[model samples]
Every structure is written in C-alpha cells, then in structure tokens.
Target chain A: MIATTTENDSAEHPAVPTAEADRPAQSEARRRRLPFSPWHLLLAPIAVLFAFPFVQMIMVSFMPSRDINRLPPRFIPTTVTLDGYRGLLERSDVLIWLTNTVIVSTVAVGSNVVLCSLAGYGFARLRFRGRNVSFLAILGTIMIPIQLLMIPTYVMFARLHLLNSLAALIVPWLATAFGVFLMRQFFLSVPRELEEAGLLDGASRLRILWHIVLPLARPSLMTLAVFTLVGSWNDLIWPVIAISDSNLFTLQIGLANFQGVRRTEWSLLMAGNVVAVLPLLVGFLVAQKHFLATMSSTGLKG
Target chain B: MARSATVAVPEDASTATGAGRRTQRRSEQLAGMAFVAPAVIVIVGLGIFPAAWATLLALQKWNGFSEPRFVGADNFERMSRDTDLVAAAWHTLLYTGLFMPVSVVGGLLLAAALNRRIRFMGLYRTAIFVPYVASAAVTGLLANFVFNPEVGVVNNVFRVLGLPQQGWLEDPSQAMVVLVIMSLWGQLGFVTVIYLAALQDVDTACLEAAEVDGASASQRFRHITVPQVAPATAFVVIWQTIQCIQLFDLVYTTTRGGPIGATTTLVYYLWEQAFRQLSFGYGSAIAWVLFVVTMVMTLVLVAIQRRRGGEQPA
Candidate 1:
C-alpha cells in the first residue's frame, strides 16, 4: 500500500517542475504573519457556536417560562429572575437527588481509585500466571454495553433487596475496565526497580505497593478519580431503572419528575438543571487541567 | 535494584536466609492475590454474571414479580413481529446516522479552528464542555423547552430571521431532527476536545512543509491534518454511534417517543417493555439486538479505521 501510493503520488505530481514556483514567495509571507493570525480569529466564532447551547441554557434559566417559547425569541432576558432556581429549590425533589448523587459519586470514586490502582499494579507489574488472560477478560467486558445487562442486573439487585438503595447505584460503577486499563498503563510506565527495592528491603507486597507505587501513580490516580466522579455524577439509566422510589433519586431522576406526561414545568426544570449542573461545572473548573491531561493521555492508549 | 538482585539469587542458600526469603516470596504472592481478588469478584459478580443472566432471561418468560419460567426463545421469536421494537430500532439507526456525521464534522471543524492559538482558549473549552458534564436528563429538559413548537427559542430565531417557523419536535417528520440536534449539542464538545488533543500531536514540520509548498489552508488541513487525526476521529465516530444507538434518556425526557413514536429508540422501547410493562423477557431480547448491532457496527468501524491508519505515513 505504501510503495504503490508513493509511486502514484510521484507519477501524478512530478515535483521538479513546479517545486521552485511554490517556494520563495510563500516562505516570505509566512515570516511576516501576526502572532494573532487571522486563522486564530476564526476560532472565536467557532467557539461561540460550540458555546451557544450552554449559554442558551443559562439564559433560558433566567427567563420566565412564558418567554421561553415565544416566537422571535429573546437571547437576553429582559425579565431575568431567580424564579427557576427558587421554584427548583422549593417545589422539586432536587435537594434529595443532589444528596444521593454526592453519596453515590463519593463511594464510586473512592472505591474505583483504590481497587483499580491495586489491580492495575498486579496486572502490570506482578509476574503472576494467567495475568494476561485475566487482563484480556476484563478488556473483553468493555465491548458489552450496559443496556444488555440492565434487566438481569435489575433482577439481581432486586433479589438482594438492594434496589432503590444507593448500593445498586455505586456497585456496578465501583470498578471500571477503563480505570484498570488506564492504571495498568500508568503502572507499566513506572520503573520496576522502585517496587523491587521496597520488596528487597523486606517490605511486604502491600507495603511496597502502598509506599512505592501509589505515590508514583498519583497523576493517573487523579485522572481515574475524576473519570469515576464524572461518570457516577452523570449516570441516569441505572438510577432510573434500579430505583423507582423518589427518595432514592439522583438529581437526574429527580429532575425527571418535572417532566409530567402532559405538561412540563419548564421553569422549574431549567432551574433544577442549573442546580444539578452547577456542582459539575464547578468540579470541572477546579480540575480542568487534570481532566484535559487525562483525556489526552487516554487517547494515547486506546 | 539491590533488593531485586538479592531476590534473584536463584535458590542460593547464601548466608542461610533462604527459608525466610522463600516465605517472603510466598507471602508476596498471597498479598498480590488478595489485592486483586476483590476487583475480580466484583467484576464477575456484578458485570459478567448479570450480563450472562440477562442473556438467559431473554430466552425465558419472566416478569420481575413472577417466578420466571422457561419459554424457549419465545421472546426472541416474538421480537421478530414486535412493531414497536422495529420502529424503535429504525429510529435508533436513523438517530445514529443523523447524529454521527453532524457531531463528527462539527468536532473536526471546531478542533481545526481552535488548534491555532486563540485568546481565551480555556474559557471557550469550558463553555463547550459544560453540556458533557451536565446530566442528560437536564440537557433533555432544556432541549424540550428550547424546541417546544409554540414557544421554543428555535422557532423564535427562525421567525426573526424571516425563515419558516417549522415545528421542531411536534411534527413527526422533524421530531428526529430535534433529537439529532440536541444530541449534537451534547456530543460536539467532547469530540472537539478529543480532536484538539489529536491535532496538538500532529507534526508541525509537516504542516509547515505543506504551507511552504503553496497549499491553501483547506488543502493543508485536508492533506496534512485530517489523516493525522484519523484515529481519534474514528474513536469519536464509533463512541458517538454507540451512544446514539442506545439513546433513551433524552428521548424519554423530551419526546417520550413522541409525535407518533418517531423518536422511540430501541433502548427506550426496551425500557418501556421490561421496566414499564414488566415484559422482562421480551425486553431482554430487544436488548440483545442492541448489543449485536452495536458490536457489529463498532467492529466494522474499527476495521475501516485500521485500514485507513495503516495507509497513512509515519
């Protein structure tokens, strides 16, 4: 493929004749460009297009429901009010859902970081038999979508009487295959001699892993923690199916109440949206660097 | 390194410390197993077992409240003629088809634009990524209001622009369009970030060469940049396609398979049948179909990607 493509390209372009014509003038023009090139100016409107929906959501949150649907729509709210947030706080089950989300995300993130890191180390560094096979099995699980397992998962939790409890929400998410994969890649990058030195010094494997590997793997751990946190925080389907009781609702399921079959309380719903999204927005802001780093590094792996 | 050297001394009874060192190696193995056992148990118990059980349940006639009885593929057989399932499947594919191209192209275009240094890059990235962090239910609720036929901002914008004020979600023909648009809104940001990361890694020297050779910006982007980000593009496409296929939350919240069930995705239908109507067996069958469709699509996509990637120069 490579040889044929290269040959075809040479045959088509015949570089010698036109090469000199292209070079000098374009080279001179490139050197005089502004630091803020016109191409850079193209970014802002594109950014605006990307940012439009979010700004619209916030704008709509401030408007009265009556104005939300008006033709010749208003972008800026003339009658900006705290009505959505107030209605969300007083009438909706938004508070309970928020609490449930916090609890579920905390547990899921904490467990994932600890378990996945240890398992990742064991898979990456330890020379245990069947390790490759075990890792492959875990990798295989990534291909199966959660939709396929919901029914049986629902039944299992129901039989265990874990339905409608935070346990069901946190359990399935506690250890992700992606986390293990990410952590393993991270562990593989750390020098083997660090753990070996600790082991040679008569440190138990747990102590060696804890004292040596964990500290070295902090960045990846942070990445995994953020992934787990975001994943648990935004999860909807499992909570929807597993917990019918409103008391058990995550912010997502709770907000689903504003959506009645006939008429939706648009103002309250948007307000509820603000409440639900605020924490995540703040969380993303605080961890934006780590989040971006994690995403880019994840791309490198898979 | 010193400690490893000691451990690697191949059963040498040097200084008569062999017994203790052997005991230590055994304990290390035990500890390793102990560390990994919990995660293994969790995956087996929670992940694999349930998935396997779901496959079995699909073959049986089971509603959660009853003693699930074996029905021997009756559920699978019935799924063949289930009109709602068929409609939902068609809608899901339509939704995937509509959503993937828009988000991918939007992502690629935005990423290309933003790859150059721009003022307030962080702020723009943050604003774009807000939808990704928000729960889909919330995004859906917002969309429902924004796309509402009578009062939606979309209609207002159209009217203001002297354009036709078409029904966004109420009209059956255009209902899927609203969902597709909303899906794009939710997905575009994530795909942009992914592409942005890929674009950052493209060789600047190669791009400079293209520029020096009198390639226009579009030509440079097409010939030099796109091929470099092909893998990330493939990843974004496959991931978005899978998510689109199982799209239930937004449709559930906004449309509820509305305006004549035009937006009922297969997962939504499965949720309705299994959880809503308690036809667990039938829903399970539908769920399997989704699994098959997703897996097959992903495989085909990955293969095309591999071939494309292999053709690219290092």
Candidate 2:
C-alpha cells in the first residue's frame, strides 16, 4: 500500500511541493473551487420534509392543551410552561412506567450482549459439524414475521404462569439472530494471530476469548449494546400484550394507556411522550457515531 | 545433499507434531461447543420449541380455560371458511404491498439526497432518524392528536388552506390511508440511513470514469449506482416487507382494526381472536397461515437475490 501510494503520488501531482504531495489534489481542488455544489443545495427541502414532524412534536409538547387542540394549530406556543411536565410527573404513573422501561431494557440489552457475542464468536471462529445448518436456521428466524410469534408467545407465557410479568417483557428477546449475525461479521474481521498467541500461552479458548477477544471487540460490542438498548427501550407491542398490571407497564405501553384513559389530557400525554422518548433520544445522541456507523455498515451493501 | 538428509529426519518429527495439532484442534472444537451451548439451548428450548408447538396448537382446540382437545385440521378448515380471516389476510397483503414500495422508494430518495455532503448533515440525519427511534406507542399517541380529524393538526393545516376538514381515523377509507402514511413516515429513516451508507461506499472512480466516458448523470446513476446498491435495496425490501406485514401497533392504537374492521390485518385479527375472544385454536390457525405467508415471501426474496447474484460481474 505504501509503495503504491508513492507511485500514485508522483504520477498525480508532480508539480506540487513534496510536503503537500500526498493530499488528494482532485477532491481538494474541487472543494476549493465550489464548496456549495448544486447537488448539496437539494438537501434543504428534503431535510425540512423529513424534519417537519419532529419539529412539530417538540413545539406541540410545550404548548398549552387548548392551543394544541385548536383547528388552526398554534405553530408556536403563546404561553410556554412546564405545566405539562408537572402534570405528567405528579398526576400520571409516568415514574413507575419509566422505572419499568429502564429495568426491561437494561435486562434485555445486558443478556443480549453476553449471549449474542458468545454465539457470534462460536459461529464465526469455531469448526463444528452442522455449523452452517445451525447458522442458517437462526437466519431463517429473521425472515419469519415477528407478529406470527406474538400470539403463540403470549399463549406460552400465559401457560407458563409468567403472564403480566417483567420476565415476559425481557426473556424472549435475550437471544436475537440479528445480533449474532452482527457479532459473527465482527469476529470474522478479527485476526487469528491474537487468539493463537493466547493459545500458545496455555490459555483456554474461553480464557483467550474473555481476556483478549472481548477487550479487542469493545467497539463492536458497544454497537451491539446500543442496538439492544435502543430496541428494547423503544419496543411497544410485546409489553402491551405481556404486561397487564399498570405498575408493570413499560413507559411506551403506559403512555398508550394514559392516552386512552385520558384522551383530552394533552398536557399529560405530551409530557409522558417527552419523558418516555427522552432517554432514547439522549442515548442515541450520545452514541450517534457508533449508531450511524453500525447502521450504514450493517444495512447497506456497498 | 546435507540439507536433504537433515530435512528427511525432521519430516517424521513434523508429521508427529501435525498429528498432535489435529488432536488439539478436536479438543478446541469440543470447547467451542461448550461456549456455544447456552445460545443453542436458549434458541431450541425457548425459540424453536415454542414455534413448533404453536404449529401443533393450530390443530388443537384450546380456549385458555379448557383442556386442549385434539381437533385435527378443524381450525384450518374453519379458517378457510371464515370471511373475516380471508378479509384480514387480504388487508395484510394490501398493507404490506402499499407499505413496502412507499417506504423503500421514499427511503431511497431521502438517502440519495442526504448522502450528499450538505450543511448541517448530521442534524438532518438525526432529525430524520428520530421517528425510527421513538416508540410506536408515543408516535401512535401523537398521531391520534395529529390526525384527530376534528382538531387534528392535519385538519388544521387543511383549514388554513381553506379546505374541508375530515376525521382521518374515524373514517374507514381515511383510516387505512392514515395508517399507511404513518408507517411510511416512521420507516423511511431506517431505509434512508441504510441506503446512505451504501451510497457512501460507491466507487467514486467508477462513477467519474463513467462521467468522463460522456455518460449522462442519469445514465451513470441508473447503470452504475443502482446495480451496485442492489444488495442493499434487496436487504431493505425484504426486511421492510416483513416489518410492514407485521404492522400492529399503529393499527392497534389508532384504529383498533376498526371503524368496522377495515384495518384488520392478520396479526390484529389473531390478537382479537386469541386474546379478546379467547378462541385460541382458530387464532393459532390464522397465526400459522401468517407464518407460512411470511416464509414464502422470504423464500421468494431469496430466490430473487440468488438470481441477481448469478447475474453479477465476477
């Protein structure tokens, strides 16, 4: 790579000073000539179109209940207040819901990371009979619509006498096939020399994995952790089916119930929406770099 | 001659070492199996068994309180005869068909637009992706307000334009439309980001080469960009179709499959039968059909992907 770089450098920019020889002259020149290309200008309308709903949601969250409900909707709040927050905090079960959401998401994400990584590593690195078959079968699960699993899962939970429990909310999601696939892809990219070095030192595969592989795989693991955390935190349907007790209801489910129970309580509902969605937004914002990288890498083909 | 003689002696010793290495490899395989056991156990015990049992339950008669009676194919036959189940299946297909094209195509456009290095690109990306990360329940709750028909922001916008106000969720025709639109809104971000990533990795040299060869921008994009991103498109289409077919939360919250079961997709219908009506056997039958439909759709998608792969340049 270094040898080719020198060749390309000499070929492309002979007249440039040696100190500036390595820069991508073409791209840099294009940047200097016209930084704001017409292509870049197309982003404005598209961004606004995509962003309108969120801006509306944020603005509406602060408005007085009556103003929010008006036919000619108030684009901006005439009187901004924390009344919605206060109402939601004091009057609703938002706190309990928030706690439940935290517990379910934490348990689910924690279990998913450990289990999926182990499975992923085994699938990626280990030699075993039926390895391909097992992996394929797991991948097959991804094709099956999750809705098909819902009724059966609910019935099974009911039979297990685990209905309306937090366990119902957390247990089934502990081993996701997608997470395994991601980890397997990541593990495949890791060099075998590191593992061989550990093995030569009389470290068992498990010990080597724990000490060397896990630490090396921190970024991928963090990506998986964030995926699990965000997914579990935002999941809405399973909790609705599984947990009937209001106290056990996660934030999402509780907010739905809150809306149904008090349709006109815009202040409470908006406040609840803000509270429920805040953690997820905060979580994503903090991990935005990892999140974006993971999104692009996993989803796109090129 | 000296080197050859020395190599001949070490060959035997090296063969012994190779044999020992093979033995070590076997033991490592056993240890690897040990490491993978927890995941396999969980998948088999919790995931596979439940799915298999559910398939069997479709053939039985159980209404939660009653002992599950072996009712062999009665549920299936009943499902075939039921108009509601038929309507529900059709609705599901309709929903999936509508959702897939709109979301995937819209996502493609948005992703292509966003992939450009524009001002505040990070903020734009986040703004678009926000809905995807928000809980369906929260979005559904907000949708209720936004599309309330009487005092909804949608109607309010219409009113501002001096147009007729309509109750989006209450009207059957409008209800389904609202559900589809809301689904498109939430799903676009996911598909767009995926496509954006794919777009970034497109070989700029290839594109520039095409441009230099006097290829129009449209021709280059169509012939080069689209084909290169085919795999991403396929991935998005298949997954999006699966997700679309499983549209439950919005339907459940916004319409409850109502204004007269006009929005009754398969899952909602299954939920209604199993949970609300306590008709477990029949509901399981519907659930099985849904599973089969999804499996078939997935297989078809796989077949398409395989065909595409076969045609790709080596």
Instruction: Find the candidate with the highest lDDT and give its number.
Output: 1
C-alpha displacement of A57 in model 1, angstroms? 3.4
Q: Put down candidate 1 lDDT per residue, B76-124, tens digits, no spaces.
A: 8898888877888789888888888889988888766654323465556
Please report, as a residue range, the 10-residue window in candidate 1 chain A with the lowest summed lDDT. Answer: A13-22
Native-referenced Cα lDDT, model 2:
0.73
lDDT of 2 at B276: 88
- TM-score for every candidate vs. truth? 0.87, 0.86
The alpha-carbon deviation from the true structure for residue B197 of candidate 1, after best TM-score superposition, in angstroms, is 2.2
Q: Which candidate is the best by DockQ?
A: 1
Candidate 1 scores an iRMS of: 8.5
Q: Taking the tens digit of each residue's C-alpha lDDT, what string does model 2 give over A263-295?
A: 877766777887887777776677666665556
lDDT of 1 at B42: 72
- Give the Cα-based TM-score of candidate 2 against the true structure: 0.86
